[model samples]
Target: MATVLLLRHGRTTANADGTLAGRLPVPLDDVGHDQARAVGERLRRLPLAGVVSSPLRRCRQTLRRALPGAAVTVERRLTECGYGDWEGRSLSELATDPLWQDVQRRPSAVSFPAGEAMAAMAARAVAAIRDWDARITAQHGPGALWLACSHGDVIKAVLADALGLHLDGFQRIVVDPASVSAIRFTPQRPFLLALNDTGGDLRALAPPPGAADSADAPVGGGSGAR
Candidate 1:
C-alpha cells in the first residue's frame, strides 16, 4: 500500500483574521511560521519521498519550512477552492447569507457564485491525491511517505472521498490549519489512518529499520472558511 499525508497549510494572515482567503496569495503570519515549524520538525524524522503543495504562497511557505530537504513540487490541482465573491471576506459578514447555509449543509448542490463547483472541486482533489499516491509509490516504493499540503476545503474533500462520503457530507470532515491526515491507498479502497491529527507522532509511517527504504526515525487551529 502507498500512503499520502494531506496537510492544511499553516495559519495565514487571512486565517488568523477569520477571512475567507479562498485562492488568494495570502502569506503565512508569524504564528503560521511557528505552526509550520512544529509540524515540519515532527515530520522531518520520516523518510519523506517528496512534498507536493498548493501553489498559493501560504502553502508553499508551509511546505518549505516543514520539509526543508525534500523534493517539492507546485501542484495547481491541490489549490484551495475558489470562493469567488466571498474571497477576502469575513465569516461574520457572510454568516446570514443563504448560500453560506447551503454550502455548509448541502455543498454538492451549490456552486460558488462566480467560482468552482463543489462537485468538481472534490473530483479534482481526489484525482490529484490518487495521482500523487501512485506516482510516489512507483518512484519510492509502497511504504512511501509523501505529503500534499493544501487548504481546508480541498483537504476535506479528499478525506470525504477516501471515506466514501458524498460531497454534501464533506463539511463534516474537519481539517484544521497545519493539521495532517493520513490515507493508505490500495486497489480495493482507500483506508484512512488518521484525521485532523495535530500532534506529532507519525513515526509509524516510516519503514521498519533496515527495511531497504532510505529513512531515519519517527515523529491545529480551526478550519478556515476555505
Candidate 2:
C-alpha cells in the first residue's frame, strides 16, 4: 500500500510545437526550465520518502530543478515511448501522411515507419511501474510515499494498467505539462486523488495519502493521451 505520485516532466521545445518526442532525448527549453522551477517550488515541502525519474533528459532536468536535494534515482524503464521515425515531427506534419492518420484511430495496429508499436509502449511502461512499486516497497517500506518524474506517454500507460482502465479510456485523460497526478494505494486497492493538477501553490496542489484534509485537494481533467 505505497503512495505513488506520477509527475510528468515540464514542457520542452517539442512540446510547445505539438511534436511527438518519443525517445528523442530533447531537453527542456527556457520556458520548460522555468516551469520546472515553479513545479519544484510547489512540491518542495511535500513529505516525499524518495524520488525517482526516467533517464531521459527532459525528466532528469525537471527532477533536478524540482527536487534539488532529494535522493534521485534514474530508471531507464520509465523513459518516454520510442516514436521511431516519427521522432521530431509535429502532429500537423504527420496528419498529411497516411501512416500517421491511420494510427490516430487504430493506435494498436499502427506503428511509425520506424517507430514502436503503441502496445509495446504501453506494456513497457506498465512493467516499469510494477518494477518501481516493487523496488520502492523493498527499499523503503510498504507505506512509503514517492515521486516519479517521467514522460507523458509512460505516465498514461502506467496509470492505465494500475487502475485497470482501458487504453481508450486513457486517451480521455490528459496530463498537462509540469502537472502532478497523485495516486494512492491501500491494501485493498488504488485510488486517483487528483489528475493533471496545475501550479498554484505547490503545497496546495495535492495531499499525501492518509492526509486528513485530502478532500480539499484541487482537481483538473483532460484525456490522459498527452
Candidate 3:
C-alpha cells in the first residue's frame, strides 16, 4: 500500500478574482507563495518519498515550496482541465456568453467550443494518478508516501476515480488552495483517508490573499463551483 497526497495549487491572480484559469499558465502571487511555504513546513513532518506536479506554473511553484529539494517529476497528465476559449474568462462573462451557457448546461457533452472534453480530461487525470501509484510501488516498496501537486479540476477527477463518485460529485468535494487530500492504495483498491483538509496552523502559515474563491470561503467552503 502507498499513501498519495493530492495538493491543490496555491492561489493565482485568476483564482483570487473568481476567473476560470482553465489550463492558463498563471504564476502564484505573494500570498500563494506564502501558502506554499506554509504547506511545505507542514509536509516536512511527513515521510514524503517523492513529489509530482502538473506542468502549469502555479502547480509547479506550489510543489517547489511544499517539497523543496525533493525529487520532483512533471506529469502533463496532471494538468488542469482545459477551458478552451474560456481559459481566462470569468463566470460572469461566461454566464452572458451563449457558448459558456452551453458549457454549464451540458459540460460533459460540450467541448470548450474548441477545448478538450471533460471525460477526456478526467480520464487523463486518473491515468496520471494510477501511473504515479504504480511508480511509487515499484520504486519504494509497497508502503510509500508520494505527493502530487495539481489543480481543482484534475484533483477532483482523481478523487472521483478513487472514490467511485460521479463527475457531478466533483462539486461535492472542496479542495482549497494548499489543502491536502490523502489516499491509500492496495493492489486491489484505493482507500480515501482524508479529503480537503486545511487545518494546519495558519498563524505560522496563512493562505495567500485571494488564493481562494469567495464562493467557497470561511475555510471549508463546502464545495461550490469547480
Best by TM-score: 1
* Candidate 3: C-alpha RMSD after superposition: 9.5
Tens-digit lDDT string for candidate 2 (67-126): 776789888778877778878888889789887655655566666667677778888777
Candidate 1 lDDT, 1-226, residue by residue in tens: 4688889999999988988999888999998999999999888877778788889999989988887767789899988888888898999998878898999889998788898888888888899999988898898887777889998999999999989998889888888889999887777677677899898588865544333232221225323212
Compute the lDDT for candidate 2.
0.74
Strongest candidate by lDDT: 1
- TM-score of each predicted structure versus truth: 0.89, 0.82, 0.82
Task: Indicate the residue-level lDDT of 22 in model 1.
Answer: 94
Worst 10 residues of 3 by lDDT: 204-213
lDDT of 3 by residue, 1-226 (tens): 4568888988888888878888877888888999998888878877677788888999888878777788788998988887788778887877888776554445456566687888788889888888888888688755577789999878877887788887655656788888888776666567666688776532222222332212222366433222
Runs in model 2 lying further than 4 Å from the true structure: 200-226
Model 1: what TM-score? 0.89
Compare candidates 1 and 3 on TM-score and give the better one: 1
